[model samples]
Target chain A: MLVGYLGPLGTYSHAAALQQYPEEELKPYGTLEAVVEGVKNSEVELAVLPVENSTNGEVRAALDALIAEIGECPEIKAVGEVRVRIAHQLFSRSSNVSQVERIYSHPQVWGQASHWLSSTLPGAKCIDCDSTSQAIERAWEDKNGAAIAGSAAGSVYGIKPLIANVSDRDENTTRFLVLAKQPAPENKQHTMVTFCAAQQDLCKTLEALVSSGVQVTFLTSRPLGTHWTYRYIVEFAGALASEQVREALAKLNQVTPVTVIGAY
Target chain B: MLVGYLGPLGTYSHAAALQQYPEEELKPYGTLEAVVEGVKNSEVELAVLPVENSTNGEVRAALDALIAEIGECPEIKAVGEVRVRIAHQLFSRSSNVSQVERIYSHPQVWGQASHWLSSTLPGAKCIDCDSTSQAIERAWEDKNGAAIAGSAAGSVYGIKPLIANVSDRDENTTRFLVLAKQPAPENKQHTMVTFCAAQQDLCKTLEALVSSGVQVTFLTSRPLGTHWTYRYIVEFAGALASEQVREALAKLNQVTPVTVIGAY
Candidate 1:
């Protein structure tokens, strides 16, 4: 098996890809676009992308990238879901934590580890790098610099951990979705759908799903960006291929706009 | 009146604060926590914080900050809402766009303007600064650097716009919420509620709101971080103080965990 993920290496996505397809060839794509492109172009069998974080909510770029491909490109469907526990390790060239004069990481990682950073390296200047791997690379090159990233990234970059499990929340985790050219085999537990509906029609649409007895697992609304109108992505406890779920979606489509994205 | 916002000066929050209270004294708080803290401590009469962006969706930090204060601290309510059009300006020490060897901006701004940058300044190295204002400050100090920020921020930092309206989307806008120690006078047009509910009970909850004939304006769910459960923030076209809305909420409370964050 071949898998693609966002990385230089040692990112949460990297861990997720490995967790899903261990012993398979894993390719690291520098950007989200590249990872999706890898799947679209058949450069890889499937791509794993971070969808949301427990603490931060949605990963905007990843969702935006997937949504952008909805109408114009090869239909990449989410086939599998994986959740990875996020444990940030502060890595530096020197093992001594006191020698760290600067800290570097992706801005979001900085937020996750802010409490530890404030208490441990109060005076260290924080620098924003493009990715956690890039931060590790910078910390490896600069003796006075440290980075917060996956512990796996530290070993990959040949840096040692200055501190372990530095994120404020021990239960911090990220949800990743596996994207491929096809949807996953019909899943009865959940079906992900995306739709755009007028403000007045929203309740009616939700009523349809509820009336049909399908349980909603996740619900999120994003602005379509031009008008005040919004786009909603929903995951409900049902299968797209099932009769009750299909009938519910059919009724929703009659009253409002809706698209069944995936079932997993 | 003194108002607090996230800023060096010239961030969307700064623009929002000025838009809401043109004649008031705007105090630039460097962090979201500080802006909320300013309101909690009565250091500023109120604060403006960016809650969501049209292009990218919710600003997780601001939402999390507000949610964190739900039970642990003094109640801070959203008193007002402001939507500002995002028109990023490329500013530099020199007026010549071709002379720009490096580009500086916040990561989100960079993502918004990536299409323009790749075509216009193909060779320029991109640097991520703490804020758009900080980006402008860096550009002002470096002759060969350019920053992407609000035009007002560029002018505030004494840097001239090399180009205007560089964001890829012309309709890009951000929605900001005004925070104060007290809630706004009850808004009949809409009420905002934040609550946690079970996945199975979600359908019953939506059915309750819709059955009461209250329109749901916005709906979003965030993972509670520890368990597989989720927390939801909802805005509906009815007042919390109204009879219909109260009846609907009371019915929901009977089945699931729910909280009324604000009436406006």
Candidate 2:
């Protein structure tokens, strides 16, 4: 199946998409909206977008895409989740890191730029860009500039790292969710879904799910950005082959209005 | 004087603006660009915009505004800095905590949300919003939904807390910078400045600041989102009156080119 994800090329999003399905060719979409749109339009069978990071929490751009697709039911659901270790590299044409006064990279890459600035190119000024790979392109264009980006982004942008594997932390990683236009991956061990609650007691609803034998793996919530209503997203494991998952969902139907955005 | 901030109302930006000159009628603008514009056009004499937060780093919307106004030199520097403790309330119309099914709040409020989501909304789902106050407004409208937002946001949105003060760390607070077209307020002890580095090694530069006798009270770095470099924002106590800070900065000038975004 064709997989679409956010990227100019060599972005963490692109990497995560490839990691989810090793054999599938990851199609790089310019934006998250486009990735989701690709699925909606049947251009791609599945899409992968970042949901959150271990340290940073949620990626709102991806979350927003999920919300926009809520009304478009059965279009997307979590098939799998990929964890990616994030390593930032400082790339430059100049051999000396100290000679780099200007740094270029995507805004997210720049967010983690402090350590590199303090330790390496301490005097470098930062400029933002559309993506990490783009930073490499700019760095290549501007000899005085270095870039803060993924090591792979360096290769994509055709630049070399003055410093490699230079993120401040070793465990730094991002979490990406797999999506598909069809039903969530079938008869599997995990099922991911998003819903709108009819009532306020989300815990109460969750207890109901647990009581019905659903095994929740990951959970998060966000505001619909509408009149005080919220949206709930849950990932649970129940043999997707079993009707038990559907039965548990039926219980939620009795107590509250639950619209499953997607089923893994 | 009436003060406006970048907000839709009940955002941290509004609270930060209010803290500087409390009892001022604080109007929330839809965007930071608007907040700067509000000051430029004299729709409001002063506005509060978050320069950077301790947690997620700089507020891109604000920095981009300043960059766009580079030539105009808004005659503004950060007048004051605020570190507001993030106290999140789990608000639902129903007093029963168990009745809450979904939680809504801004990304900044996430630290406060983990407890409630783990202990309370774990079974429910999570969603992200542009602001904490907006989350409350949405949650307040849904009977089954709850919000993890600021106390100020709850008060304005008419959301009743199922639980009060839920942050992973009590120190969960955000720092905000106050700005105006002209000087707003000053403490001889503190001067907030934004600068571009001659080098990206901010840590070493900060060390130089220390060696030069600059006592840094707070420091934050963020991606400029321009081409590929980031901006390092720092706050420290030293009299601009002393000319010592400038001298130290001038010394740093040799190490890196410095563009003082603002100083007051």
Candidate 3:
């Protein structure tokens, strides 16, 4: 099976893809939208995309792509999830960290490793790249450059790791979702839904779920292309096949149209 | 009054500060944390910091700083809010847009103007800076460089706006909070609260608020330094002094200790 992931390779999404489909053929896509598109077009059998980070909250780009694409292509659904423990390392062409004047990485990586960067390389200029692998490639070519990435990216670019686990949080992890043309076999572990409702109806909508006795595991709100109006993405612990989930979703749909993204 | 903001005089925070205190002495700080520190230390009478953007959702760094600082310094509170309409422009040293080889801006600015950048200057390499004003400074020095910033930044850096309103969304706005040593005089407009609760109690906690008849205006959840545990920040259309708000908060505190960030 061909699996697509957002990458030039060595992204956290790539890591998650590898973990979930160890022996599958992996293809690199430039953006989350493209990865979803690959699955939508059947160019790839499956695709992996990062959804949330332990410290960064929701990955907005991924959520945005999923919300937009799933609305149009109802067949495409999130079928599985993989959690990748993030471990950032400072890689350099030279072993001397003091001489490094420029550091490069994805913007998110820079934020995760900011505490280490400030304490160790306070004077270095931080540059942003599209991916951690791209950062390593750039560092490999620059004389006074360093990059923060995972061990996989460091090995890929033949860069030596000068320091390991530089992120501020030791247990930082990212959650990745596997998207396919059909939903996963019902497991009763979790169900994800997205909907938009007026402020007055939000409580009513949420109450529908709570009164059904399903625990909401995750909830986030994003602006719906307007100033203060918002749409909510919610995850609850239940299967669509269950009576409680079916009843809850029915009531939720009555309050506001609910799109069931997936049940896994 | 002396006001502090994250700035080099051209950032959006600077614009918000100026709008709120046109005649006050404005000082620039390097980060949102520093802006909060300015108020905590009484170095500035008040400070302005961006809290949420319509396009980008919550400003994580700002929220983190506010959460961390408020825990220790309860005297500091958000007293007022200013919503600044975000209008991004492509500013360049040269008039020829085709000649621009690099684009510089804060990471958030890059994301906001990504659509325009991809369509207009598809080949330009984007470099991240600490602030849009810093991006303007970098662009000013590079002959083949352009930056995405507001008109205020363009004027400050003596760069010309090659294109106007490059953001994908026209009604994009950022909500900034005014931080001071004391809460604003009582107003029944809005109140903000934050707290951490287990997954099982989240519905019950929210129900407490809804039962008291306060309309929840905004709600967002961030991981509480753990894998799945989360803390929520919520905004409601009520005042702290209002009977409904006080009753709601008291009920909410029963489920989870609630921190009233401010009422404005």
Name the candidate that leads on lDDT.
3
**TM-score pick, better of 2 and 3:** 3
Candidate 3, TM-score vs. the true structure?
A: 0.93
Which regions of candidate 2 are displaced past 4 Å? A18-26, A111-123, A197-199, A241-248, A261-264, B1-264
Rank list by DockQ:
1, 3, 2
> Residue B179 CA error for candidate 1 (Å)?
2.3
The residue-by-residue lDDT of candidate 3 on A58-113, one tens digit each, is 88888899888998898888888889999999888888999899999987777677
> How far in Å is the alpha carbon of A249 misplaced in model 1?
2.0
Overlapping backbone residue pairs in candidate 1 total 0
Model 1 lDDT at residue B213: 74
lDDT of 2 by residue, B134-190 (tens): 787777788888777777776666656778877665555565656667653433556
Candidate 1 clash pair list: none
Which residue segments of model 3 deviate by more than 4 Å?
A155-160, B157-160
lDDT of 1 by residue, B127-200 (tens): 97879989988887899998899976866766568797899889888888888888545754667778777666
Reference-based lDDT, residue B116, model 3: 84
For residues A131-179, write the lDDT of model 1, one tens digit per residue. 8988988887899998889977876777667688898889888889888
Tell me how far the alpha carbon of residue B33 in candidate 3 is from the true structure, in angstroms, after superposition.
Answer: 1.5
Q: How well does each candidate reproduce the native contacts, as fnat? A: 0.72, 0.00, 0.64
Q: Model 2 over residues A1-264: C-alpha lDDT tens digits?
A: 788988888788877776677898778889887888888887888788787654344576687677677566555666667888788887888888767778888756554555646776666777877788888878878888887788667666666677887766566678777777666555666665666542244434554565565655444444432322346665556655567678767776766666554444
TM for chain B in all models? 0.90, 0.81, 0.97
Model 1 chain A worst lDDT run, 10 consecutive residues: A67-76
Instruction: Give the whole-model CA lDDT for all candidates, comma-separated.
Output: 0.80, 0.65, 0.86
> Candidate 1: lDDT of A114?
72
